[model samples]
Target: MDNRVLYERLGGVFAIAAVVDDFIDRVLSSPALNANPLVREAHHRVAPAGFKYLVTEQLCHAAGGPQRYTGRDMKTSHAELRISEDEWQAFLDLLKQSLDKFRVPLREQGEIFAIVQSTQTDIVV
Candidate 1:
């Protein structure tokens, strides 16, 4: 019901987009992530718009955007990739770097990280 909470949660779509851009840039630049064929050629180019929407919608809902996440499940999409532990760690590290690079506040970072972390098992297995 509170628009301001939603705004704060979402941080505006542009803010979320900025963070995503930073994160994706870092991920792309990281040798660990770039080395993966799925990421390098397939996932990287194709996933951004969906990713952005995912973040925006989740943040908006978490922060109080109205839209519920009815998207495809994570495990289904990521399970086949067979991501290794090292690569998973690299993904997380770059994610942290991206948030830090953009100066996302600690609370916000923690919140976002927690939300993202929820997908780890599905994504990494």
Candidate 2:
């Protein structure tokens, strides 16, 4: 069995950051997610680079990398946006697209999905 942590398997910070960069760009440009005025406003308010940085940090930490996530909790970050089930699914679809773009293997995708799923309750209102 492969003994390396998910972070290492994912090629550590650089690879993970690349994925996050794509994912965040996809998210920020998604009409489905921005349909909600609150979400649209939030997306417009945040700097894309900083948003990517936070997401990369979060994923890196979740995947057992050395970086610590310094962003707010999922609930606090998403609470006012009031994300819906459909919107959440749309977000997942974008995530899948990003992972596919990176050619991330099934195992790594599953692990990443698990981490994202764990935060769903906090993110979805």
Candidate 3:
């Protein structure tokens, strides 16, 4: 029985970073997410490259890669935004689009979805 981690299965940090880049771009441009003033302000204030770097680190860590995420935790980072269920759903939709664009396998996508979903309680108000 093989026991390869999700990070290896997904082709490691580079692949994960590519997905994160697209996902972050989609999220930053989302009208639904930016509708919240707090979200809008943060999106505009943060440099896109830095945002992508943090997100890539986080995703790599979550996917069981060697990278350690140095950014703020999910709750602290998102708390002020007052994210709603609708916005969260929109974010997930964007994630799905990004994964689909990269042709991530269904099994891997499910694993990634579970990892992201684990943060739902912290992210959604």
Name the best candidate (by TM-score).
2
> What RMSD does model 3 have?
1.1
TM-score, per-candidate, Cα-based: 0.75, 0.98, 0.96
Better of 1 and 3 by TM-score: 3
Model 1, range 7-28, lDDT digits (tens) per residue?
4654676777687777766765
Estimate the lDDT of model 2.
Answer: 0.95
Instruction: Report the lDDT of model 3 for residue 75.
Output: 93
Tens digits of lDDT, candidate 3, 1-125:
43799999999988998999899999999999999999999999999999999989988898889999999999999889999999999999999999999999999999999999999999999
lDDT of 3 at 40: 97
**For candidate 3, which ten residues in a row score worst on lDDT?**
1-10
Backbone clashes under 3 angstroms, per model? 1, 0, 0
Segments in model 1 whose C-alpha atoms lie over 4 Å from true places: 1-10, 44-55, 58-63, 68-71
Candidate order by decreasing TM-score: 2, 3, 1
Q: Lowest lDDT 10-mer window, candidate 2?
A: 1-10
